[model samples]
Target: MIEVGSLTRRYGTTVAVDGLSFDVRPGTVTGILGTDGSGKSTTTRLILGLDGPDAGHVRINSRPIWRALLAAVRGRGAVRSPLLPPRSQRPTPSGALAAGGGMDPSRVGEVLGTVGIAGVARRRAGAFSLGMAQQLGIAGVLLRDPGVLLLDEPVNGLDPEGVRWISNLMRSPVARAP
Candidate 1:
């Protein structure tokens, strides 16, 4: 369970989020959707505790989002957007995922396999298209298997098959559990 009350954020004169309130109940997938400049990302950041709200409150599963946000959000990239290294870097998806310490090869493999990109585990990320890049980003988040998921435009550039994979995952019991 995630809840927000009067969540508000301002930058100079711009109000990124304003008096927003909502609840994300288990057994369902909620989305913060809007047009450009609608503060969708800002709201997500605030919920994940990556950014502070000027005049509001947030809670997840009956607790404040203080300690569990990292595991919840996975990183800024998952809920904000992906930061892909240049193709010339020739980074493999699996290697790229395992670059940081603590994550083992099997975890990387499981995530890639779930996203249906296991075949490209050894392929250079630089060789991937926009859709594939989106999948990789999704795989990155799925690797954490967080209790709460906060994805942004997760299906933006995916092909039909990829879209189905993500939709299924998001609609699965994991995303809908109480």
Candidate 2:
């Protein structure tokens, strides 16, 4: 569950979000709808603890995400952004291979296949098409098996087929229950 109460954000003289409040309950998909610059992304950022609120508070599963992220950073160092390998290099880390202990390199291949991008799994993500990038992002999110998903324009660059796949995936019982 994610809850936002009287959340507000400002950028200099501009107020991006103004006194917003909402609850994203468990076991359901909640859509945050607004035009561009209407605080949609800002709200998501606040909920994810990527930004501080000038007022009000947000909570995830009854615990504040800001506090949780701070605690996580304190315990494990700040979470570093995942880096995509160079075009000439392998996408999966050598450490991943070491962790698998020389199992067929097909484990990563299988995950890519599951996301419908096995054919281009070896390709650099930097060079992938926008739709492919969206698939990869979805795959990354799926890797965590998160109970709560916060997607900003998730269908923005997807094709009809890809959009359907994502819709179906989000509507799956596990996602709904989570």
Candidate 3:
């Protein structure tokens, strides 16, 4: 479960999120609706521990996500950027493959396959179409098997088929499970 209590975020004099509170329970889809500048992305970032809240608390599975992320980082370095160059360009002999305990190189192929883009596994994301990039993004999220998903403009740039596929994918029970 993800819980937010009296969350607030401010940028100088501007208030992005004000005392926002909500809960995203397991086995449920809680959509955050708002205009482009309505703090939706800010709230998601706060919940994911990507940004600090000026006030309030956020808890995931009864533990603070920031604390958890910090701990994870302390133990295994920070998560690697998904935009890193492919194995062929890396300095290591392994090439573009993730070094150490980062994301599994084999899983990259698996996720691409899961998202129905296995044929383009070797292609750089920068060169992919918008829909293909979106699929890769979804595949990246699936890598962690998160119980709660927070998508920002998830349907952006997707074709009709791609949009439908994402809608069905998010509604599936398999997506709600940890």
Candidate 4:
């Protein structure tokens, strides 16, 4: 579970996330929605331990997120936030994921297939359209079969069909497992 309590962040004089608190229990899909400049991305980054909160705490599975930062960075609870760029621009979909350091290289094909981009597995991800790039990012997120998923604007550049596919993937039992 993700338990965020009294979380806050500031950029100079501007407040980004202010005392935000919430729990995302197992077997559920929680969304943080807001306008473009809202703190949604900031909150996700804080939860992922990619950014430090000025005040308050973020706990994942009863452990403060700092304790889990190593695992998180290693891909146990991978995040798919759009704000993060792909690992690289030059490698093919397969090459990029294989180079991510951990996990079986064989699983690269499986994730690509799962995201419906197996046909482009050998193509340079740099040349992909926005929607396909989104798929590539998702495939990277799934490389280690993450236990916690934090997707920000996951469907932003997707087509109608791609959006539906992502919606279904989020609702699937596999995605909801603790």
Candidate 5:
């Protein structure tokens, strides 16, 4: 459901991504791997429309994500980044998930519960530990029930238990389907 064709990006004189192309089909997991400064984050940003590709295109569900956003009122797609907001500066879990609409309190609660942070649903996300913050970010993505899910280092901050939770959640049959 996600497609990248001839993707390229550059910053000043540095080339970050070069003619990248790949497809993430519906109901499957795909990972982009590389060492630091290898353009993984840049690629993710391009796919999510957070950054423009110097030359290339990214599409979700056969339409550009921006177009999809305009066509659908909810659940077009979602992503979480590695640079999370500061705990004290972040919004409450529910508020963050519902900020752009498409989710209600119960859905937010369900996502928070799935990520093992429901007990602190009303707390400011900025107060959570790194692992908890990661969970909340994952929860925000799940709340979308998106046609596409683009995650960049989603488990980077999790403890073993939290890592297992994300593993099981993503492997669930429901999560596997588009």
Candidate 6:
């Protein structure tokens, strides 16, 4: 579970988040939406412990998140900005998963296949199209078999078929398993 209590953040005179509070239970899909610059990203940052909250707290699974590193480790899955490594440092999807650590080597092919990009599992990520890259990111998330998934603009570059694929995947019983 994710719990946010009276969270607040300010940038100089501007308020990015104000007294935000919510509870996200396990096996559910939650989305934060708003106009541009309406504190959506700021709230996500605060929840992830990427930035400090001025007046509230964030907890995951009943434990307060005290540091950025702990927050990163605690999350089952997340897709933040700049979805992949920079173009210059791109690696094959298999290699990328290897770099993330604690992942089973055999699962690389399995996850790639799950995301419908198995044929390109060995291709350099830098050369993949935007949709393929999004698939790669989703594959990474699925590799963890996470009970929680925080995806921002998950369908940003997908084709119709790809979009449908992801939708079905997210709604699958496996995705909601704890």
Ranking by lDDT: 4, 6, 1, 5, 3, 2
**Candidate 3's TM-score:** 0.74
| lDDT scores in order | 0.77, 0.66, 0.67, 0.81, 0.76, 0.80
Give the runs in model 5 whose Cα sits over 4 Å from its true position.
Answer: 64-69, 82-103, 122-126
TM-score of 6: 0.83
Q: For residues 57-118, write the lDDT of model 5, one tens digit per residue.
A: 88877897678556543544454543356645677878877774668888888878877889
Cα RMSD for candidates in order: 3.0, 4.9, 4.7, 2.9, 3.1, 2.6
- Can you tell me which runs of candidate 4 are displaced by over 4 Å? 71-89, 102-106
Residue 46 CA error for candidate 3 (Å)? 0.6
Worst 10-residue lDDT window, candidate 4: 75-84
Cα lDDT tens digits, model 1, 68-166, are 565445432354565577767758989988885357999899888877889999988887877788878777766666556678788777788878887
What's the C-alpha lDDT at position 69 in model 6? 44
Local error of candidate 3 at residue 57 (angstroms): 1.4
The whole-model C-alpha lDDT of candidate 2 against the native structure comes to: 0.66
- Runs of candidate 6 with Cα error greater than 4 angstroms are 67-75, 86-89
TM-score of each: 0.81, 0.74, 0.74, 0.84, 0.79, 0.83
Cα lDDT tens digits for candidate 2, 13-120: 999999999998777877788898899888878877888999999886677776666543322111113334556653443233223344345555554566677777
lDDT of 4 at 85: 45
Candidate 4 C-alpha lDDT tens digits along 49-92 = 88999999998777899996775555345435432345474678
Clashing pairs in 5: 87-126, 87-127, 88-126
Clashes of each: 1, 0, 3, 0, 3, 0
